[model samples]
Target: MEAHLLPCKISSDGMHVDVQAGFVREETDSISFSGHSVQKANFRGRPIFGTKLPIPPPYEAVLAHPTDSLGDKEPARLFVKSKVSSITLWNLSDEPKASDKIPSAMLWLKLAPLIHSDVTYSN
Candidate 1:
């Protein structure tokens, strides 16, 4: 799989990085974020289910909405320790751009209510 580090902007909470998975887009496969530690998370918007790393990545996955109409929707969220110095996403077909600004509050609002509160959510 071709991997690339995307240019991401940092928010108060975490960084925003866009990754383009060039080859691996199967409905059942999940991507792993590797840094000082490795974090495995599904690209779907489902709540995170695992332990939190003290030395976290520079960005947190808030949502992982699919960009295209492939009908393969997978929203994900991640947590970074501080500002994102860099970002490397695996299984990417092409290089992706980065942004420091977070997505619109409305988007979060739209998604927050949809997700079940019982589901564990952390950043």
Candidate 2:
């Protein structure tokens, strides 16, 4: 997957800008992967590091967009653009680690089911 890690955040809602040509393609073109775990890229002169994590079973990463044409009383619709079993979590200062907040949260997700399951020991 081609992804870029931008340093700044945009605080606007529903604002569309053409980033494919100016940002994504450019940054992705320069991305370099180390072994199978780490990815490196430069965005606007700042280095970026990323690690790929597989979304555990029964879960996936979805890319969706709001569908146009909504009436005043009609519910909003979304169009699914793509889906993936894993995601590349990017960090500006360092390679993403399992100890990071998001990764830790994913770990909790994996453990929650087991923790809450009803198990009987036959002794």
Candidate with best TM-score: 2
What is candidate 1's lDDT per residue for 50-69, written digit by digit as tens?
A: 11122233324332333345
Q: How much RMSD separates candidate 2 from the native structure?
A: 5.5
In order of appearance, the predictions have TM-scores of: 0.16, 0.64
Candidate 2 residue pairs in backbone clash: none
Q: Candidate 2, which segments miss by more than 4 Å at Cα? A: 1-35, 68-75
> lDDT value for candidate 2?
0.65
Please list the residue runs of candidate 1 whose C-alpha ends up more than 4 Å from where it truly belongs after superposition: 1-35, 45-84, 92-123
Q: Could you give me the TM-score of model 1 versus the true structure?
A: 0.16
Which TM-score value belongs to model 2?
Answer: 0.64
The models' CA-based lDDT, in order, is 0.31, 0.65
Q: Report backbone clashes per prediction.
A: 17, 0
